[model samples]
Target: MRKATFIIPAIVIVMAIIMSSVFIVDERQRALVLRFGDIRSEIEEPGLNFRIPIIEQIVLYDSRIQSLDTAPIEVTPSDDRRLVVDAFARYRIIDTRQFRLAVGNGGLREADRLLEDILNPQIRAVLGADGVTSNTILSSDRAELMQRITAQARVLAEPLGLDVLDVRLKQTALPLQNLEATFARMRAEREREATDERARGEEAAQRVRAQADRTVVELVSDSAREAEIIRGEADAERNRIFAEAFGQDPDFFEFYRSMTAYERALTGENSSMVLSPDSAFFDFFAQPGGRAPAAVPAPVE
Candidate 1:
């Protein structure tokens, strides 16, 4: 009974020691074995791993790609325009030993801080460089600027065992204080453009109206000239007809002319005229055949 108790206790102690010394490294993880605060081994492959019990410690780190979102940072471009930039980075822990050495016990949290430090300066340097205006940052050219930032950040972060795979600008915007002023300037510019367009339209309309007015005047003058020509021609035709008729029959022509003259002279409802009955105006009236009366032999003087 005494031997059995000792054997069971020995087996239990051995099992406990084996459990503490053995660990499983997941496929997505990298493991480090440390002894007396010094790294003794790095386990990259996933599977069973062993460490000295009670004297060695194991630290596991995720080996997958990770993302870090930086705080909004303000930068001034070459043009002195201030902008707020929000950025993010995709990274992976490439060297677990180097990462642990750099960040100590703080692990991923400290690494993230170091990464931000590296990223912010590169962002500022590339975005605020000469000729890199706020307009450039807000345009498609911003992609190139992000690439520059990523290249620079990769260089700086390599020492921290971080591989900065990609960096991107999440949002780029004018400062809150400048937004209203910018909007006002844009509104003013649009208003000026609108006014110019309206003025051009009015000028075009004036030119069209002037052309139409000139056309109307020319048409009226042409019509008046044609009417005058027609009237003159008609008068000449009438005079020729009258002359021909008179040549054909003087007595009849005289009678017709006398009738027309009387019709014109006696016009209104209350028309009155005073003339001697013996006047030549009554020649047609005195002779039924429209012949003038033979002059009576003048009294012997």
Candidate 2:
């Protein structure tokens, strides 16, 4: 009975001791063993671990890709405009020894501190010195800019034994008031340009219309003058033809003219006048050139 009691107690104590010294190393986890508040060893693989129960301390970290989000920072551009900028990065520990010496605070709080002290100033310098805009956080040269920033970050992280793989800009925006003012200015400029273009078009249209109207009036006047000249020439030609035809028939033309004159002067409505034998009218009846004969013509025998 005495031996049985001692054995049971010993087993219980052994179980408790084993439980205290035992730890789990998951596939995705890496651990740093610290003794006397300093890195004593590193476990880069996943398996079971044994330690001095109260003397050694272990710190675990995810060996997979990890991310860090930085706080929003205000950056001034070459144009003297201020923009609020925020960003993040992805990184992993490539060397376990370096990681143990390099890692400090593993959360966003530490990232914020690093951003405030080192990253923000570098970002401003690069962004300001760029041949581009002062607000050039992310741009066509974003990759190059980020590369420069990563180099600087790597230097800062060297003491902590961390490597900065990449940095990315999440968002960039101006102050609300500045944004509103920018929009207003853009709208006004566009509207003014459109108005000027429209005025120019109208002026061009007016010029075209004036030219057309002037041409129309000139064409009409020219046409009317040409038609009048043609008509006058035609009348003149008819008169010339009539004069030529008249020269070919002198006796008939005279007789016709005298008959026309008689028709005009002696109308049926007016009474006829009797003239003396020696009258001027009788002369033309007797002989040509208005001469009357000395004696009347005798009747035919």
Candidate 3:
């Protein structure tokens, strides 16, 4: 009888423990309580929660930040250049009820896939309104584009209860098919500009050098002309002074110059001369009177 009583109490205690088991919900979770494998249609906040064991289940949801990485998208520019654009998004569950009804727990992945299709076209549409090509847009306009991508994605996702916080472009570049052609064009343009700039610099340097050379020629020619004039003037001044000195005794100067000429012309080792005793040279050699010159006056007795 005592054994039967112990067995009955043990059974009751085990059933109570099973029925009273509770789940702890942290600060970042929102959950749905499922009754008999069906959602109870009410969402619960974070706290200690109880449910019937073996008959009910807790479906937890992430209420904090979450991320979705999208596949690379292909976009064309105003100039028809193609590029590959990779994007990502930051989102959080804002309205649990709508999220559950619209996406369900299993539907988030499918929703993300849907988001990719929706956001890319929006990106293309906005980008098509721009003046730049895909390559330029990819290079310099990434920040503006990222904001646009997020804004467009938010518009598409906000109605579905997933609040898209931000969208970002992870990578952007020309499509592999167009990579070589685009890069070659860019390189050629840069090289052509460099060539033009170098040509301009060389031309300027040549002009400056030419100007310096012309100035040097002009200066040298002017100096030579001035020196010639000064030399000519000095010669004329010397001739005038000599003429004035010779006027002091004209006949003596004439005789003295003639004697110097005779000495120079006749005394040289390679010289020969012929002269008459009565030649004009005799006029100077004769005595002061009209008489013929006497023999050298016998030792000046």
Q: Pick the candidate with the highest lDDT.
A: 1
The better-scoring model by lDDT among 1 and 3 is: 1
- Number of the predicted model whose TM-score against the real structure is largest: 1
lDDT (Cα, tens digit) per residue for candidate 2, span 231-282: 9999899779757867997555555555455556577886587877665334
What is the Å distance of residue 92 in model 3 from its true position?
A: 0.6
lDDT of 1 at 30: 98
Q: Which scores higher on TM-score, 1 or 2?
A: 1
The 10-residue segment of model 2 with minimum total lDDT is: 292-301
Models, CA RMSD each = 5.5, 9.2, 7.3
lDDT of candidate 3 at residue 101, scale 0 to 100: 67
Q: In order, what lDDT does every prediction score?
A: 0.90, 0.71, 0.74
Report the lDDT tens digits of candidate 3 across residue range 1-301. Answer: 9999999999998878765668777788887777875677445557887877777877777788888888887787788877787778888878766676666656567667666777778777766666757655767676787777778778788767788888877877778878889889999999999999999999999999999999999999999999999998997997787588678875555655556655655675787668776655445456452333321111110
Q: Which stretches of candidate 2 lie over 4 Å from their true place?
A: 95-112, 134-139, 237-301
